[model samples]
Target chain A: MAIKHQQPDLVPLFIRYVGAVSSKLSRIHGIAGRDLEIKLGNDGVIVQIGINAEYSHKVVPDGERWTSEWGVTYEGMRGISQPVDHPLKEPDVSGYIWPDPHKPERMAEIKQAMARYHSDYAVMVDLSCTFLEAGYAHLRGMEKFMMDLHLSRDFACQVLDGLNTYYTALGVHAIEQGIDIIRIGDDIAGQNGMLVPPKLWRELVKPRMESMIHAFRKANPNIIVKYHSCGDFSAIIPDLIDLGVDFIGTMQPCGQQVDMAAIKAKYGDKLAFLGGLDTQQLLPNGSPEEVREAVKDVLRSYAPGGGYVFMPGHYVNLDVPLENVWALLSAVHDYRRYPLNFD
Target chain B: MEISTQDGERSMAEIMKSGTLEKLAQAVLEGAAEDAKRLTEKALSESLPPNTVLVEGLSAGMTVVGGLFRRNEMFIPEVLLSARAMRFGMEVLRPLLAETGAKPVGKVILGTVAGDLHDIGKDIVHMMLEGAGFQVFNLGINVEAHKFIEAFQEHKAPVIALSALLSTTMPQQKAVIEAFEKAGLRGEVKILIGGAPVTQEYADKIGADGFAPDAASAVLKAKELLGIS
Candidate 1:
C-alpha cells in the first residue's frame, strides 16, 4: 500500500541489523534467528542469496580467511566478512568460472522463508552486490575495476554481462517463487556522490540492470523492485524510476539526501522510500531520547500521505546501543500510524 | 635550438612560449599518461632541470586538477586519471630529482586504520599528496596502530593521515591516536583523520589534529598542518 501511495495501518518497518547487533538482541530476547527479527519489530525478512550473502551476511571467525564460490577471499572482522582478495587480477574474464546460480540449494533459504513468513510479512530476495559492486568488490578490486572502466571498457562490459546473465536467471527464479520484493543493489555511490560518473554508470551498468528488471518483471510484473545503494545516488533515482523501480532504499542522509523533506516532496509520488534515519551518528552515538526524537522527526518528514518505510540508513552495526535500538522501534510504533500526529 | 632562459620572470615566459612544459601540464590535465610520459621525456631531453619539469609541468597540472575537484567540476575517476598521469611523469623524474637532492615539500605517512580494508579513499589521498609534492609513506589497508607508529619512526614524517570507512572500524582511528599518545609521540606529529563516516567532530573527539572530507581537502589540510604555504 505504501508503494501504491496509500497509507497502511502504520508505516511498515524493515530494519536490518548486522551480525553482532542481531546476536546481541537475540541474547537479550532468549531467541535466535527469525524470531529475534520479529521480536525486534521487523515488518519484513530478507533472504540474501548471492555474492551479497557471502560477502556481507556470512560471519567468519576472526583471524580466519575463507574463499567464496566465486573465488574471492574474505576475512572475518567484527561479525562481518570483508573481501580481502578479488579473483580477477586483470581485465580478462575468459578463464573465470562463475558460481552456478541455477543450483537448487540456492533457493532453499528463500523457500523456507516463504513458507514461514510469506503469509504475514514481506519476503525480499536480496541479489545485491549485484553488478558494479560485484565487479569491483568481488571479481576485480576497486582500483582495478574502476581503472578498467576507463582503460578496458570491453572487458568491464564482459564482466558486467556475466554478472547480469547470472543474476537475471537467479532473480527470475526467485520471482517465480512469488517473493514480495526483489532487492538489487550496489555501492556505486559514496557519501558525497556517484563513485562512477553518471554517464559511465548509464553506459555500463544501466542497460544490464534494465534487462535484469525486464526479466524480473516478465516473471512477475507485480513484484516490487527495490533499488538500494549505501550513499547518495539521487543522481540515478530518476533513472531507477524509469527502469520500473517501485521502491528505493537506504536513502542515507548525506549530500543531496540531507534534505529529506525536499527529496520526499520531489519523488514521493513516483517512489516509496525506506531507510532515512542516520546510522552514522544518531543510532550509535546519540542518547535514547535523541534517537526517539529523531525517529519521530523522520516519520513526520517521510510518512505523510504514505510512501515511506521506516529504517535506519544502513544496517544497525555493533556500534549502536541496545537502548537506541529500543528507542528506534518504540518511536516508530508511536509515530508510524496513518495521519501521523507528533503531538 | 639552445634555450638558455633559466632565471625568474623571463624563464617562465620562455617556457610558456616554448609550450613543452605547458603541453606536459595539459597532458596531465587530460589524463593522457603516454602523452605525459612522452612530454616528460621531451622536457628532460631539452635539458630542463628535473625540479623544473616537476614544479612547472606535473605539479602545475595537479594544482588545476585539485581546484577543479574542489569546485566539483571533476570527480574521483577523472582526478584519479590525472593522478595516474602525474605518476607517469614522476616515474621519469624521481631518480633525477634524487640526484639533484631536490627535497619534497615535506614527508607524510598515510594509512587506513586497523581492521578497515577500504583503501580507495586513502589511495586517493596518497596520490593527491604525492601530486602536491609530499613524500608519502602509504602503509596500505588494514594497517595496525603499531605499524603506523613504526612507519612514523622510520620516516619521521611530521603528519599522519588515517582513513576509516566503516563505523565499526572508525574506533580504530581513536585506538591509533591512543597508541601514539601511549608511545609519547603524540606531541611530535599532527594526525589527520577522514573517511565516509568521519567528521570534524569525530576528529576532535579522537584528538586528531585535523579532519578532511575528501582527497582535495586532505591536501590542503596536510599543508596547513605542516605549515606549508
Candidate 2:
C-alpha cells in the first residue's frame, strides 16, 4: 500500500535556525579555542569572559605526523594530534562552563546576552555542560569538581538545578525580549542510543529539563521549547512530549532503527521534528546532488506538516564540504509549496 | 514380537518424514515467533529434546534470517523481531538444558566502553547473542577497563564485545583491550568492537579480534570466532 502523505494548512513556513551564518537576528555564534573562561562566582551568578582567539591550531609541528596509537604519546602532548584526539573535535562544542547562579550580577550579564539575541523569532543559547564533557573531565580527574550524576545525586542535582535555573532565566529573559523559541541542547545519546538508562534519565536528567521548559512556559506561555538529543530515543518520546518539549533536534537518520516517517506519524502533532538529514554520510562524503536529494527526502517525509524543521543530524563537522552545506541551504530556499502542495 | 513393534515405529517415522523441523525453522526466520513457538511446542510435546528444538527449529530459522541480514536483503527491525522471537523460544529451553549441565552453546561478555555511556548497540548485540544460543553477561554502559577486566576474570568469558558510539570513547575500547593484553588474557578472549563511527579498518587497526557492522553479524562473528559450526 502506498503511504498517504498529509499536508498542513500553512504554506511555506519560514522556520528560523541557529548555526546558519546569516544576517538573521538569532544565528548561532561560536567562541572557539581556550581563550574563553566561565566560572561559578561565590555569589552564585554566572560570568563569561570571552578571550581573543590566539591561534586556530593548538599544536606546533616538529617534523612528526600525529598518530593516536596504543600506548602512544600522551594526548595533547606532542606531534600533530589525530582528528579524534583534537580538543576542537571533542563532543562538547561549548568552550566553557557557566558562572554560578547565586551571583545576581553574573546572572544579569547572561540575561543581558539573552535579551540581545531574543526577538520575535526563536533564539538559541547553547550551554556548555554535557555528560560527555563531564565524563571526559572525570577521566582527566575532574570528577570531584564536575557534576557526577551517577554517584552523587545531590551534587548532580545542585549543578543541573543551577544550570536549568540559568537556562530558564535566559529563556524568560528571551521571552521578555520578544523571542518566540528557546532551544536547549544536551547530548544525551550516543550513535546507538542513550548513554544512560531511560530510568536514570527520568530520575536525573528529565526533571532539570522539565524545570527549564516549565519555567520558560511560565514566562511566555506561547514560547516554543526545543531540546536536542542525538541517536535513537524511541523509548522516551512519550516522556519528552509529556514534559512539554515543543521540538526535538539532532535526529540521526542512519542510527539503529530510526525511521523519520514513523517518528513524524507518532509525534508530529505533540512535538515538532528537527534535524533529519544525515550529517555523518551526506554532509561529509556525499556530492551536492546527494545532499539535495537527502534534503528533499527529509522534506517529503516529515515536512508535509507545519511541525517539521530541517537541519543536519548534528553540527556540520569542519571536514564537511562547503558545497554540500550550500546544497542543503539551497534546497531549503528553493523548496516551494506548489505542485506537491505540502505546507 | 519386538521386531514387529520396531517395524511399526519405522512406519510411523516414515509417515512424519516431511521435515517439520525445517518448516518451523522457516517460520522463525520470517520473524514469526508466535508461529514458531506454537509449532515448536507441538514438536516439543512429542518428546523432542530441547536441543533438537533449538538446532532444527529456532537456530535453523535464525541461520536463514542471519544470512539474509548479511546480504542486506533484510533490514534491522525485521532482523531484530526475528531475533526476539528466537530468544523467546530459547528462554523456554534455557533452564531445562542447564539442568543437564549443558552450558550455553557459546559465551559472551558485552559492555559500552568507559567514557562512553551508549548502550543501544550493546543491548542489541546482547539480544542477538542470546538468540544465537550464547550466554551473555552485560556490564551496562560507561564500563571501565577494570570492570571489564574483573568481569572477564570472573566469567572467563571467551568472547568480549566492546561498544562505543563516540570517537573519544572508541579509544577507551583500546584501553580495555590493552588491559586484557597486560593480564596476558588478550589472546584467550576474542574481542569484538562496534558502534556508529566504527569500521572494520578501525577494529583491525586497534588489533580487535573481530568487527561487526550490525547486531546480526555480531552473532555470526561470535560463532565463527568460537568455531561454532
lDDT scores in order: 0.89, 0.60
State the lDDT of candidate 1 residue by residue for B1-229, as single tens digits: 5546556645655655368899999999999999999999988887788888898899889888878876656767777888889999999999999999999998989999888889888998898888888999999988999998999999999999999998888999999889999999999999999999999999998789999998889999999998988
Candidate 1: Cα lDDT at B30: 90
Tell me how far the alpha carbon of residue A328 in candidate 1 is from the true structure, in angstroms, after superposition.
Answer: 1.2
* DockQ, cand. 1: 0.63
Which ten contiguous residues of candidate 1 chain B have the minimum total lDDT?
B8-17
Q: Name the top lDDT candidate.
A: 1
**Residue-level lDDT tens digits of model 1 in A225-342:** 9999989899999899889899998999988998899999999999999989999988999999999999988887788998998899998989998889888888888888777889
Evaluate fnat for each of the predicted models and list the values in order: 0.45, 0.03
Q: Pick the candidate with the highest TM-score.
A: 1
**What value does the lDDT take at residue B6 in candidate 2?**
60
Superposed by TM-score, candidate 2 places the C-alpha of residue A14 at a distance from the truth, in angstroms, of: 10
Model 2, span A277-306: residue lDDT tens: 786556766899988888778777777646
